[model samples]
Target chain A: MQDLLLYISLIAAITYLGFKAYTIFFKKEKSCGNGSCGCD
Target chain B: MKKLKVALIGNPNVGKTTLFNRLCGVNQKTGNYPGVTVDKKQGNFTHLSHSIDVIDLPGFDSIYPKSLDEELVVDFLKENSGNSDVDKLLFIADGTNIKKNLYLLSQIKDLGYDIVLAINMMDVAKRKGILIDKEAIAEEFGVHVVKISARKGQGVDELKSAILLESPEMKTDKLIYLKPENHGVLMNYVKECVSENPYKAFLNITQENRIPEINVKKWKTEEAILRYQYVRKIIDKTIKIDKSLASDATTRIDRILLHKVFGYVIFMFVLLVIFQSVFSLSAYPMDLIDQFFSWLSGTLSSTLPPGSFSDLITQGLIPGIGGVIIFVPQIVILFLFFALLDESGYMNRIIFLMDRLMQKVGMSGKSVIPLISSFACAVPAIMATRTIENKRERLITIMVAPLLTCSARLPVYTILIGLLVPDQFYYGISLQALVLLAMYLLGIFTSAIAALVFKYIIKNKYKSFFITEMPSYLVPSFKNVMLTIWENTKSFVWSAGKIIVAASIILYVLATNGGEKFDKAETHIMTEFAQLPDSKKDAMVSTYQLENSYLGNLGKTIEPAIIPLGYDWKIGIALISSIAAREVFVGTMAIIYNIDSDEEMKITQRLDSEINANTGERTFNFATCISLLLFYAFSLQCMSTIAVTYKETKSFKWTSVQFLYMTILAYVVSLIAYQMLS
Candidate 1:
């Protein structure tokens, strides 16, 4: 059960970072300032 | 509603922005003007059944283009010259500098545009006992002159009404034409090229536009000389300065402030104060922020059912983001100081005074504002490079700006200084404060050297002109300063908050989950410490898990590369993660070391007690800390700055050159520091 949770958390974290990267670089949106931050 | 287009054009420091802010209020939008990198502000408002679209053009010195940025302004003007769509040119002139301001107006007048002279800073003029005969000047120029104090909300409605009520039929041929005695060839060429408007022909008689190069230079020089000679004559007749009503306050103060020897000393002292304030005064708020995050993490860890979700928030996310958000106070303070300098008009004086010295280093006096602003953050500082007309100097300023110890690096410095550097007093100064100031000075010195190198390397054929206007010093406006601080602080938080939060969670995952050894963290620590207390046992488990995790192995992989810098695997991890931002170094260290510890200690205490696995020596020793500092000082660490550079230059090639150069410089410098210290 513990191992499953750890894997889930890791995947979630990585997915979040990937989303951020996509917004910052690929979307070419102003992800840094004015609350856009590319997190979407 | 149909819209009418008009541009607000002026010399620098003429309150054009103030009037634009008033006209647009919350209705302004910024967009690039065609192909130029210069973003022009477009605003809209309804006045008396008319929807007005106002385009505030960047300030330029003269009609004759000196820089590409200035050329864009002329290009916009020339395109709109005979076009009926562009309604009017609202020429803003400084009341105090009527003559020089009028020179630009005179050039515009010669261009045969329907122009209105909006004389700003009338309040300042009135106080100085300098009175302008507006009607007389208007009659002389054959243009409508509206006296206004744009800053004080006085005569603004009148000016707006003047723009709104202005008819298309009012043509001003108000400029005095100069047919200099020696320039007969230029006059004849002007006569041959332009059949309709002789004024337009002479004004724009460029070498490419049907004139010889030699004749063009002679004609241009004569034109400027003639304009100034005409301006002097106008000033003599119309403007009056009452010496009794106003003492020469700015000049009297400038003598001590701008003294050749004293000026540099004063500048150094000002920098020393700013650094000291940042390091010493920010302790209280920084501590509160640190403690709050620690508590939040502790509460989440205890309350969230002892699962991965709990660990993720407590260990991975909170520490990661809390590290960056904590530095907001310092960032605000830094920007506030800069705003004060600018509003007080001392910023322009600094540029004026520093121009000669800066030229020696391949930077302009204009680069000073951007470079100084970099001490807070580099994104806006690079944006501020637009004011620098020289492309090569602007690029160099943008490239070297990050070397200045920004607010992000402040966290890294403060933490290390607290941990490794003792709170000893040296010559009546706190030793830590001295070290912080020294780091800042090092950044400045290195940036100077880098500019010198790039001066020769960066190829440019366009002439670099650094002529700057010296504005009279005034009391810093509290309202304007606060507005500036609020806007800048918002941008910093929004941008930094996103990266810090996302990176934290990701780093947390990297540190938390690992292969076989990490999975057996409890078993390994439990067996090794059977008699140890539960608290101690838990700490041992965290330490063990981190040492055995995927992150731990990854750190070990990079250890060899960073070993010469006196950094252990743990430091290597922090170093790698901190490439996202310099401040992330502290939080990465915090999350790795502070987990499961009962006592809510600061990251500084944890780093101080952290021992290296190989040698059993303390990891954050004097040598290691200094090496890390040197690396961060020279590194291209902030992704946002590199992104901004790419955006500004619109070239990946220049961006890569900047990144590679800074990284190489950081590595070499850090290696040297570690070798010398360790």
Candidate 2:
């Protein structure tokens, strides 16, 4: 159970980090201060 | 349920967003200052068995567009006018300045859309002894009028009920007619166009330039004069002010607060108080949070089985998130002060105060909004530059915006200050708070100098003008201030937390697991120090294992480059990781220290107690902390900022120039600070 949980947690963390990086850098879709890009 | 689409339109800072918040229960950014809403925000609410969708639009002075965001509103209105796409228009007007606000309302009223003219800020107007004959105004304009105080929640229910009523299209009997004979193509185009309203057709044609032969500049100036003249006549008949009962309180306060010399003195004093309060007020909560996380980590370590998963939880995630969570008190306090200043209408005064200084630096007073907005984050601040009309000024504002210390850098500064600066007060001012203030001031000073440099580099002949309206001084709404704090705090944690947690997990894996040298570290340490006691041997082995770990090797690779700035391999690791975001530096340090240390301590404690094995000196000394702070202040560490800068400039050349200059400045400043202080 411990081993399985560790693997799952690791994968989840990696996946989230990967997705966040891709969105911020590649997709260029990050929001702050009203959560909208305010772009036309 | 019936579906209704109502677009909320008004002049800026006239409580359009406040009314929208009241209707939709959505906490969009509202301020006493203008141009807060730069884009149309949508929210839906169910009322009277009707589903109403509200579009909160950017406030503009005229029906015609001036800036990009205003262009969006004009386009939206043009598309939806007299069409089923938009069911009605909700025109919110400032009751105190109805004469000025009604100009835009009159234009929209002439557009032939069913309008519910909500006279907002009725509370403020009443206090000023101004009374509006709503019935007379309604009769004159041929639209429904509702008196509302969006701040006080007065008559909001009545306004909602009014919104549901299907009023007949009311065009003012007095129309400012354009010359059809002189502009034959415009009249012909308006007739053929789907828009039945010739005013809307004219505004659209001028902007779109379908028929370029029309003298648009002359026509626009004529239209404005005619509209304001009409608005003046309506106001004269419908509103009354009692001179005896009117208050000069706002003017009285502005006299002192806007004084030439005393104004700046008071502003500096206010900043000092804010910084001092941030440290003093949040100290107890920050300490409590720190202790709680330490206890939780210790408890989890003993309770769980001695395994990688337990280690990950206790060492990786807890410390990672705790590092960020510990600084929440400070972040909350900083934003609370900002929200209060914004809500109470003082932020506008600061803009007005700084306008002179900004002009001297070759920037308009309008540049202050984006520069100040950069305090929260540079991403939206860069986006907010859309409000600035001049190309050169806007570009300069964008280039220097990221130099302002954002909320992301707060955690890094807090921890570093906690490690290096004493908590004692000198003459009722906190030393730690003083250092923090210096960091912020450094950002402001650096950005101003950078703007001056860019003013010359990015040349433009077109001059920009600064015109800001001072909102009447009123007590900031308690509910709004609290909501602003709640919303910002939530955004900070969730946004920074996600990055911190992920970085912590990856760091833990790299720090704890390695192949050849990490596996043999214990044996090598024991053999090298055979005569040492078993306890000492264990400590040596732990140190050896960490140094040979994958993360350790990676840090060592870049350690030489950062060594001159008084940084070790671990600090180098943090520098590399924090490029994703600034707040991640604390989390990275937390994870790195928690993994190597035998006993659990707060990040500040670990950092303070950190020693160089070679020199036996403190790692985070005054010099190092100051260096780190300066680096963070000047460097463009945020990926979102870089991305948004690119999106805004749409030029790789400018973005690259901004990035290179900022990074080089950060390096040179850090190098000087570290070298001199040591």
Best model number under DockQ: 2
Candidate 1 clash pair list: A31-A37, A32-B495, B141-B174
| C-alpha positional error of residue A39 in candidate 2 after TM-score superposition, expressed in Å | 2.9
Candidate 2: CAPRI quality band: medium
Position B187, candidate 2: lDDT: 60
lDDT of each: 0.78, 0.83
Q: Please write out the lDDT profile of model 1 over residues B421-496, one tens digit for every residue.
A: 7877776667787788889889989999999999899987655555565567888889999998998778767766
Residue-level lDDT tens digits of model 2 in B287-386: 8998999899889988999988898999899988998998889888998999999999999999999898899777899899998989988987898998
Off by over 4 Å in 1: A1-16, A26-40, B1-99, B105-195, B201-247, B424-428, B525-538, B596-599
Interface RMSD values for all candidates: 4.9, 1.7
Tell the DockQ for candidate 2. 0.50
Question: lDDT for model 2, on a 0 to 1 scale?
Answer: 0.83
TM-score of each: 0.70, 0.72
